[model samples]
Target: MPFTVLTILAALLVAAFLGYTMLRGRRSDEPTAAYDLRVYREQLAGVDRDLARGVIGQADAERVRTEISRRILAADTQMRGEKAQSGPSSVTSAVAVIAVALVLIGGAWLMYHRIGAAGFPDMPLSERLELAEELRVNRPSQAAAEEQTTPVQPPKLEESYAQLLQKLRDTVAQRPDDLQGHILLAQHETNAGNFKAGYEAQRRVIELSGSEASAEAYSNLAEMMILAAGGYVSPEAEEALRQALERSPDLGPARYYWGQMLAQTGRPDIAYRVWLDTLRSAPAGAPWADAIRSQMDDLAFRAGVFNPPQLPVASPGPTQEDMEAASELTAEERQDMIRGMVNQLSDRLATEGGSPEEWARLIAALGVLGDKERAIGIRDEALSVFAGNDNALQMIAAAAQQAGIAQ
Candidate 1:
């Protein structure tokens, strides 16, 4: 704090000095040229004295006197010119001082407020990293963070719909171990902006699922928790995301939330990289896709990427109706359908050598089919293909994570 104060004081002093010099410009009776005039006149007198004392001959004295007179004339002209152009007028000087002060002091303050962490003392890199870790560890829990937030207004529902929701909630309360009931309750409540209730139901869903819980379940829990806390990624929410990643590391929503958590915890550089990969691969219109897109420019700036690559236009893929139709198929039929597409993709990628996005999709598809060995091999080859490309590497790594393959 003392050093900051001293630095500010020094800046003010330098500004004062600059303003004074500019305002005082050439406004003096003894301008540099005026002083030169005096020196020339004295030299002319010295020449006369030298002649009287026989220090030089008459011709030499005359020549010296003439040279001094010419210098005096030139100095007199310069002095008059300096006097005429002497600095700005009083009003102009005042305006100039104000402008300088504003640019130097006011501008500095504005820039600092935009980017600086006010009141934070400078620390060594290691100390800063330690402090960041401590903050991550000690940040508020989901419940506490939710308590500090104002609840969002729930959307209006028809009388019949509202009553049906209430009945479902009551049913879940009575049958606390009913996983599907809790899941339905969670989905509806979250849709209605009743995030607190949504997260509560989601917690029960996770508890019942236990080891059987899919990554989507844990990721959904984290999502509701974040929404309940007014978008703050609390420690509890982060734990839910960690659990999701443990189950399926390439889980899109979980990676999205993990990136957000990293940014919140002062690791924006890593978050920037994480989001760059995740955003490109997230299915079009997913909640996290839009959220990540909205935040990428700011995150890129924070990560020192002044000119980040053009954001990928999330390509049109499967529609919700299409996905629902696929979900209706029997297990064997659906598996056969997926296997066919996966085989086609695998062949195309092998022969044609497709995009990073395609390779990532293929890897994730293999993971879904429980083909970890093929997924790992495909991941390795993909890494080799895009060895020097950082963004491609991140993409492959995100998919590789799902199959438990370390980069």
Candidate 2:
């Protein structure tokens, strides 16, 4: 980019210099030449001094003096005729230089501005000019922007998921009992939504990390296990949730999801109470805040506590037992389960009775069933039901990949 910019600048400079030289050449050929008066007067004085000092013969000095006088008289006549033209021409040249500079600078700025093509496709022409002018006028503001824009240092390569996983696996393979390695593995697995792997890892973390670290690991494992349960509302999910809550009652996500599980299992009143506790105790803007709010509204509507929002209702997610069972299934069995899920989802879509959450559940079920094309079609229709969300996009992509379906 820098080389291209320099090449462009060199071209413009050459053009300007050529234009200035052509103009000067045209002026130089004029019959009425512009001469400096001081140099003419100095030459006349030098002739007079030479004549007085007898450095030159009087006749020779006199002849030279006559020629000089004639040239001075002719110059005075020309200056009188061209004074108005000279002043205006000088001003015009100066204005031309200024104008050319502005044009060159403006063109350069526009070209450079286009370098940010990846991010700002919708920039308007007026906005581009305004930004360029602002940047030129404020050096300090420009400096601040430059500092802000410097590329962020890349995170340590060793900490990356792939590298860390390899290291953890190697350590576990050698020791087969390293708890820290297990804890790292569990965290990675949970993040990747492999809850069974996470559960195994968390067990190792508990063994190696002692009671305090074990408590945290257990909480982490419990949350993921609940997600994998697949809405069956199992006893294991409930027990894990209870243990996690006992360890850290203020964990907002656990509280919110636990309340959701309760609502699913014919305990709306209990769920409503739990959500109320969550709202009061959980920090505002915490990760689970939205879930808590939505769940609260759902439970309240179910218990006839208040009118609900116009948003569509959704079915609860899988239970821990369901996830554990699914994880143990052979690949063929898993495919069968996915196909069954897709059929069920198709029926639900035909009925169109499920709320937005139910529709999302249906979408995910289709992806899991290896019906990427159909899943995307359903997703398009169901998108209006749920507001746009980053997590929703990621989940769809993940499910599609797992089912060996191209997104």
Candidate 3:
């Protein structure tokens, strides 16, 4: 009722203001023509004074006097013409003011009826956060239950590979307490695109690891679940990600996925902050870094944060000709070339104590080459070098963890 009263009062104030502006008589302190003529007369007197004082030549003073007199005559004529024309009729002015007030009020009403949430109650921040929390608790369970009842078609695979997978599954079941076996099975299933099975296997790995489970284990489980749900970050997945963050606050995958959850939940401002912070702290070439970088600017703008300048499109990597030339090389030659490049990068970093991003790339490369020992060594060296820089250390550690290096 108070709001309605206030709104009506505001409308009345606007109408009154507009009506007065339209009906008010134009009362100039002095008429425009009269003001101009007075200025011109003053100029003529100044020219006469200048001539008397011998400050100007007589010819120059006469020229200035003539110009001033001509302006005075023009002003006098204009003032007479203005006086002859009558002002707007009082009735006409009243009609115009009324028409304008009605239009403004009626137009505002029409626009509000068309586009405004006329009947909706205000949703304050506290209420919104409560609703979000409720959804977080209830939605995932419902989704998981529905998933269990729904039949899923498994991807086709070679008979031998399928047999091998079944054997691994059987081995994990027999040795339910074997954490390493569950972890291996989970990884293998994920690699084969069997995310549903991988999700189950990863859950078992988390259970077996118990209190020893690191953020990476929980994050991996969350990722598998997301994959199983066709990339939907269900509440269950969100819960797992939350746990991951609780264990390791800067876990890259968890932070990235948490941002995704925030965005999906219609909290763009929070999501923008999360993704931006993650991007700032993330190592270059980290698994999640590129995705976060590509999306952050758009999210920031949507969240009413500053609009970022458009970044130039990056050049495409490794042209067709270059790929073809590389393809022509023997497997051994390619391996040797890659190893050489990796070695050079390692040497440079060791000598120069390069960026955390560079150190992350070196660790990832070693992992890819099946040199977990070397990757671990590099991770340790990077941690020591960046000991005082917590953000850098976190980025490198997360990258190494993602790359399967023992931390």
Computed on alpha carbons, the lDDT of every model, listed in order, comes to 0.86, 0.63, 0.79
- The order of the candidates by lDDT, greatest first, is 1, 3, 2
lDDT of 3: 0.79
TM-score, cand. 2 vs. native:
0.35
Which ranking of candidates, highest TM-score first?
1, 3, 2
TM-score for each candidate, following the candidate numbering: 0.60, 0.35, 0.51
Which runs of model 2 end up more than 4 angstroms from their true locations?
A: 1-164, 213-215, 231-233, 307-407
Q: Give the lowest summed-lDDT range of ten residues in model 3.
A: 310-319
Best by TM-score: 1
Off by over 4 Å in 1: 1-119, 319-407
lDDT of 2 by residue, 86-168 (tens): 43365676677667766776766666667644333465658755664454344232224324443333334445776776777
Q: Give the Cα error of residue 381 in candidate 2, in Å.
A: 43
* Clashing pairs for predicted structure model 3, backbone only: none
Best prediction by lDDT: 1
Please state every model's RMSD to the true fold in angstroms: 11.7, 26.5, 12.7
- What's the number of clashes in each of the models? 0, 9, 0
